[model samples]
Target chain A: MHTLTDAALVGVVLASFLALGTSRLTSCIRATAIQGWLLALLSVAIHEWPPTGHTFFIAAVSLVMKGILIPILLERAIRQASVRREVEPFIGYASSLVLGGILVVTAFGIAGRLPLPHQTSSTLLVPTALSTLMIGLLLLVSRTKALNQVVGYLVAENGIFIFGMSLTREVPLLIEAGILLDVFVGVFVMGIVMYQINQEFDRLDTRNLNLLKD
Target chain B: MLRLLVLAPAAAGALAFLLRANAHRLALLVAVALLHAGLVLGTWTALPPADLDGHLALDALGQLFLTLLSVLFVPVSAYACAYLSHDTGRPNRTFVGCLLFFLSAMTLVTLSQSLGLLWVAVEATTLASAPLIYHHRSPRALEATWKYLVICSVGIALALLGTFFLAMAASDPRSGATPLLLPELVLLARAHALSIPWLRGGFVLLLIGYGTKMGLAPLHTWLPDAHSEAPSPASALLSGALLNCAFLGILRVLHVCVAADQAAFAQDLLVVLGLGSMGVAAAFILKQPDYKRMLAYSSVEHMGILALGVGLGGAGVFGALFHAVNHSLTKALLFLAAGNLLLAYQSKSVSDVTGALRRLPLTGVLFLAGFFAITGTPPFGMFLSEFTILSVAATHGRYLVATLYVGFLAMVFIGMGNIVLRMVQGDAPAPAASGHGPPSSHAPSPAAASRESWFLTAPPCCLAAAALLLGVWMPPGVHAALDRAVAAVAG
Candidate 1:
């Protein structure tokens, strides 16, 4: 069980990198959904003895809402738009991969320096979670597609979710639920907005909508 | 009491959404602002008892801001009501709705005791104000709306991460264990967490994120587009209310960082950004053609001064907060006055219209007063506040810093002054005096002379008066509040 938690946590980091590396929008969305599912399993695994009902509910919402509902909404938004693929980003794919590598290493180096006394068992998760966060931010900065930015926002949020799950033992049930709901609605709203932007602007390319410049 | 204070405008907003008539909806908005001012003024009595919520409470700092916001909002709301008394296109329902919600968010920001809740409220303000900025629905306004949404969302997201790091900084303490609140974190900083490197990183992130919203340059690309694109009343609220909300967020984090023993480091960063924004403003203000956008950049300039004063500490922090109050009133006045100009002449470009002083004396005079007040001249609160900041900087042996900052401000004054004198003094633009139109014969009716009601003239005049009054006199309670707040910072 511990090994499974560790591997899924590791997968969260890999998924974030995959999210950044992919030019195809659907591939990135799928990777984010998988990350969400992994995060749900990880959220449940933090507690032994079959988990409390609250943790079970969080895991279910994470699986159903973030893992299923959101990705589908994003996919629908993608289908409604003309931008079906990322041809080339502002930062090329190869450089993004290299930057992702540097961010992961930086996260680990910084985590090792911190003096956190709790949850040393999840040491690997800490670095992975933080690295995923950095990767998500890199995606947000480098990607021009509104669809891609939405995915980046989700992945960044997933990184936070994984980090929150790592501390499930410490965080109260109510707060965890609140955080999940906030993320849920935020992604949902962003998804609807992306589709609307796609429909209104005749494309999902956020960069092309640069008419607001001073 | 806190819950009611926070929830009133929200309830009004929801009710306004249901109303059908534009006039009725706008009336509800003015009522909300008036009621909000009343509630905040009445809350002053409770200040005698020292209101706080362990982490979230109305202290001397919060009370002072609350008083400024509540007082400044009333006339702006009243003006919005009269301006929108008759309008076409999409129902004023949505505009009124967003306006009330924006009010609720500012109310929350002013009273927030915890860093976490404060962030949520600040983020909420961005979302609520988006629809308000898009009220005109032109292509340009839509584009401005998009920038405001995306830039503010991303900036605020960074702030959330910063808040997470602040929590992590507190994670090492055992006695000050469990949930993070500002007051508790202050106590924690007094002992543990002060040395934590993560805490410093958090302060830097917060400065960038909230600094972006506060219209500090480099992070201030959204201010010009949004301010010019929005309705004048919306511009007033954005420049006046929303910027202060972000400033309060930065101040909250600075309060925490100060307790963390690394306030010197944080102050240095603020000084650099402060100077950077002032430089950006000086460069832009030199050849500014668009009147509304010029006012927006002027706002950026004043915001930089506020940051510089707060960063300098001593009497400087006191003056910065006072300057923030003055800026909010005067800038709101300026934007509202600019709205009247746009309404009268149907253009924001300074080259397109001339002789506002002769064409519309009330709005012209008030706009000039706002320009004078904002540029740090006498008989305005900003002048007094700017002087106090200079005195503090010199006293603190920051002679070179004081000289450089004041010089940038003087250049700004010259740049802005030249434009205002040109627009207000020359012969009234030929087309403006006749029934001739703005570049085209078919102008929007809202731009016609019929629209220049008291709504167009009254708000800025009232706000300018308030700014002048505050500049000349320090009322008993306001002085006490500032003294206590300064003592708290210097503690």
Candidate 2:
């Protein structure tokens, strides 16, 4: 049996797409949680055959930090902000989907030229990683709300983490753990800033920050 | 030894936190900065032989940058004591502590031997300096600090992702092995150069990521706010030193690409980014409202010029190196001098403040002198170094980029000139006409205006003097070092 690890990554990518295309914020967050679970599983499997125990520790942290904790924190922020609307975005949903589609094609096209190791299970891993990354960028750029952008950044980190996971043996699992810790701090900081923005402006719109222009 | 550079300041920072003696902490701050600078200079001059944990090393590039940060920071750090004398914060200790921590972070950035370590260092610099930028706690300063942290943190995260890709590049050939050390990678790249196409992609991401921090085009939105809203001494550190650390990160990646024989591809991307930044600056400088922000945009322009020179290759690299030093010194002088004008007039808007010379003679004179020096007028190091870059550009066949560069620079000159001339030469307006916004007003008293402190004036004077000295005479030994730095890039 190939185990549920590979199947879980496939499910994660699908959930990542659903998160991108989802209209409701809560559902998107749920999809992101699923992606986090898939990532945690992926991280755990790296040590099973290779016996790199740091991988197991990192997977545990990812599960605790990303899957369970971050969603709860984001959900709490949402309740505090009380912003439940899909809200008007810079770009409409259809165009965002189109742009995200183009980005996915471009990512795989770019990845096709790289010299992949022959023995690797999925040379498509890099392309999928890049596609998810591009989708995160899409979400960030298309959104008008501050909270959505924070979610976008978290999703971007998830894409990068999954990408780095594929190179587990080469990158010393310790560095990956450090990377996750840094991302955790980044999200925590952004969340705090978003709260401040809400308190100051009485709304979640980030476009109102145009006061600094020359 | 390398660890001491970090630990000394860190220990001083903690002590400043606990001791609660402002005057004693200020003295300790200067002593620590001097001692740290001395350590960096001592190691650089002697070529001290040590590398901690192979994750940090003093290569030729690091040595050169280490020496620059050391020599340049000594005066700025000393001036900070007098600069912060005006800040009304209760725990003056936090600012002092952050200053030391900021220095430690910058030193780490210079000495980091691994790419990942360098990312950590650069990000730490961001964290350490955020509070320093918000030292005044004014609304404007708070806004600038928030923007700085959020933008820089995101940029750094993108850079971290690029590092992940670089690790993947190494993984393709070897499994469970590839230590993330620069020396090994550089050597490995030279031999297995064919497998590095993926690394080229990584470099593009790396350049864009670091370039955002370096205030290159399209991504340089945070720079003008952060620079203008920050204290003059902090602006000096940001322009003179911090930008260089980010540039050094890009240089390391460029070196890796060079070792892989992939330099040509990277150079094109840099040239485009560089020229694009200059173009954006020229477009905006024509109607710049705030004097400090105008200077900040000018900084963005100068960074573009540095990148353009680097992209040109050959003697262009030499000129770029020289220009980097010139730009740092002159830009610091300009910003510090601008600070004087801002204080005297109680406004940074060009339209609101007039007749700087009639109101505040010392600041007005320094402002004029600073403007001339920065705009590459005669008898300043900026002029000489900019000439070097132009000549190198002409000598190479980049005549089109050369012409466009000169054209855009001239436009910036006329644009900035109209503002500076109007602001500094006419009659002073009535005090009622002063655009002193309440809640953030800092109108200086006549006594303060009449007696400009030697502390403030001395730093700008020394910086301006260095620019003049470089223009008139560059000693052969210093020239030789710059030549070596240039040759290292070109080779």
RMSD of each: 2.9, 3.1
Q: Can you write out model 2's per-residue Cα lDDT over B223-295, one digit (the tens) per residue? A: 9999888887788888888888898888887777777788788888888888989989888888999988898
On DockQ, the leading prediction is 2
Q: For residues B418-471, could you state the per-residue lDDT of candidate 1 as single tens digits?
A: 899888897786653544544443254634444357776887888988899988
The 10-residue segment with the lowest total lDDT in model 2 chain B: B438-447
All candidates: TM-score:
0.92, 0.91
In lDDT terms, how accurate is model 1?
Answer: 0.79
Per-model DockQ against the true two-chain complex: 0.36, 0.36
DockQ, 0 to 1 scale, candidate 2: 0.36
Q: Residue B314's C-alpha lDDT in candidate 1? A: 71
- Give the Cα lDDT of each candidate: 0.79, 0.76
